[model samples]
Target: MSCNAASAAGPRIVSMNVCSDQLVLSLADPDQILGLSRCSRAAGQPGPAAKARTSPRLSGGAEDVLLLKPDLVVVSLFDKRATRDLLKAHGLSLVEFTVPRTLDEVKDQIRAMGDVLQHPQRAQADIARLDAAVAQVRAVASAHHYRVLPLERRGFVAGDSSLISSLLAATGLTNAAGELGLGAGGFASLEAIVQLRPDFILVSEAGNHAEDEGRAFLLHPALERFYPEGKRIVLPERLTVCGGVMLADALDRLTEELKRVTR
Candidate 1:
């Protein structure tokens, strides 16, 4: 938790956000993990570093994190300001990372984390794998004719600067929402979505499946009616939430669905 820089090199690290928790755990040694957020250990949720979470878990909060005595703490912009301020007040060395909206931003974040962690090799390897996956999807999609609409109704649709939009472009799929001129993350009206009339619909396979809650705009009755006969792609939130190795996994699923729907 507190170490002079002279002796702090390669100090223990803790991640406070789910996405960052996963990424840091993936890149760090097991002994290097000080603790993780509470959400990381939840069953059936995309979570903290798998290895670190396999044993007992650490609760995510300023007090819990301070108790761990980590050398560096990775916090996301999405984390509460109070949590961050408390940790800083405790004299913990912290690095704040922005939630990436575009693919470039995602890659940049990965590399930046890699740089901070001194694990450039691991980061490079992951990025290379992602690049290969994107290329593979693009090749297969180019020969096909059907386009895709990266739809998310759990509140918002993928728009101009989002990672979903970046991946759609990488895979050679067209995004109908952007064509309709929606700006960013938030609810998209049903009428606006139907007017786009995309060739296929992509919806979250997980999250609250309720039609009335956080992402209900994507699950509106009108959407079902509009795309009843078209292809549908169901994706897990983690894949599209942040860009990382899991993205390739999501894209593979996407490529398979796109091929099926297009055929």
Candidate 2:
């Protein structure tokens, strides 16, 4: 259905992707949500996942979505194209969101989704909350100007153009990945990471525990030596993965983590 044709109270929506699930949960009225993706209810998940628990969940299948007879379906760029195609072919109105890499882009998405959901006032309120939270982080971050790197699983470093990098900037930290010559992000060699010696290594988790090979990179001997304990800041993956209402929490968490490490 076209945006003009959507109900003023908002369309009955089905979110087929985790990120979209969060957006819908945050922006849409509870009754407007027809169904949410199964991942939105995963154990220990953060952000809007909790709100998804009582809602109906889709199996990430076109048939399941079709059964709901939703007025609109939300997905992300990362979702399977065939599934999107199948839904579109069957005459479902769809909104596919791209991964946002900056605060401005994130706001644009919030506003866009708000427009689609017919909740412009709620979207503006969310944007205001997000701005206030970011300002709070920026206030503390502007003082120290630390050099930080968002070192992720499998040795990947988030570059200057990434959402993590944008968040780092908002928090008054420099993305060490830019210094290492990575623009959009890439795998940094162990030796290169060691040589850069950033003031702190921002990770999704702390401690020496490694859940898998990808996570093992964060626990590497070299990293441990350079960024032991207090030298690392853990932001939790859920906060950083997608841009939406959760970002307000993410920015607040960054500020707190920065304070913890800097102290």
Candidate 3:
């Protein structure tokens, strides 16, 4: 469905997850965002996920969502089913999308959500802008020779099929983790990481606790012995969690840090 046609009535959208938060906020105008989940809001900033919090804060319950009187509710499949049931009971229109695992999935979700919001044109434009930003960063990476290792101690780092891994490849860096035979998901052993010896580490800030554990792994006696100081890089999970314009931000930070190390 093309967003070229103008709709007199725009849907009031409520986003329930971080990935959805990025998509819903980007495509909808301020007035269209009826509510945003509290998880989207990060430290000190008005939700790292949402561009701006024009929507009412949703605390994962049906009570406040009912108050929004939304025309459309967007949710993640992983979110509590009780919330979905409650919203549906009120006869509100609903759309659900799985967390994106590939860049193509990101684009598909954008287009799909845009169609639902009656603003496909805006979604196309936003996606184009996001693509351009990714290309810009990729151009810079094309000129360099960097080995990237997606780091996750508690969970396995991104692999060949993962979105984060695709983003790393998008920037022209080789993911050493994939090279050393870690498949598409979950925790990695310290010894395996040592064997990879990546030129740079792409640690995803899954959350504060996960980020802390990842950071601590860097300082572990075994890991430290393997990787010299100053070779590790920690990137906020938001940047790599989903394919968005923010990827350029991650590339900029990663490239800068990698350059410093290689220099």
Candidate 4:
């Protein structure tokens, strides 16, 4: 379909990436979504699973999307190259988004999708709420200055270049990862993490048991003893994995978790 057709009553959209899936699901009308990526409903997929389940999950095929004749297809720069080429070959109108690294970029993305989905007001509303959430967190953070490390399995650290770091700074908390000289992000050794002595490590989950080598690393005996439940923050991967309206919820939870843990 020609791009001009999307100007009418919210385009029929197919999201080919999980991040964009979250954005589309957040801002689009139910009928406006034509399909979602196959991984859109995978474990830890952000946003509303019910809305995602209501649509067909694409199996990395562009032909089916062509048949659907969606007014727009959203993809990321990192999406499969062959599939992107195939969709381009068919001249399907497409919008591309890059992974956002800062809070402002996240807001821009939400605003962009808002226009794409014909729901600018909803996007603005979500942005306002996100701003309010940030304000709340800032209030709490101003009274407390602690370093938080957004740690992941295998000691992966979310560093200064990530959206999480931006959120941390915006709310008055510090990302301990930046202190380790990891600007974009990198892995940390157990010894390094212990030496850093962060006030808290932000984990995606609060698993006390290990299910695999990666999970095992996080639950290493030493970690369990040092960064136990009360010492670690449990912000689900779904909430922090991608930056979108979910960040509003993330910010709110950060507020509550900070209040609970510091008290």
lDDT of 2 by residue, 1-263 (tens): 56555575679899887777778889998888999987888874554655688799888889989988899899887889999999999998899899999988989989999998889888899999999988898787778778998898899998988998887776677898999899989999999999999999988887777889999988888889889989998888988788898989988888898778777
Worst 10 residues of 2 by lDDT: 42-51
Model 3, position 68, has a per-residue lDDT of 80
State the lDDT of candidate 4 residue by residue for 1-263, as single tens digits. 45565666668989998999999988998988889998988987787989998888888788888889887899999888888888888888789999999999999999999988889999999899999999999998866788999998899999898989999999999999988989989999999998889999898877577888988888888887888888888777778778799999999999988888888
**Candidate numbers, best TM-score first, in rank order:** 4, 2, 1, 3
Task: Go through the candidates in order and give each one's C-alpha lDDT.
Answer: 0.71, 0.86, 0.70, 0.88
How does each model score on TM-score? 0.84, 0.93, 0.82, 0.93
The sequence of per-residue lDDT tens digits that candidate 3 reaches over residues 117-182 is 888998788678667756766666767757878776553677787877776776687777666667
Sorted on lDDT, highest at the top, how do the candidates line up?
4, 2, 1, 3
TM-score of 2: 0.93
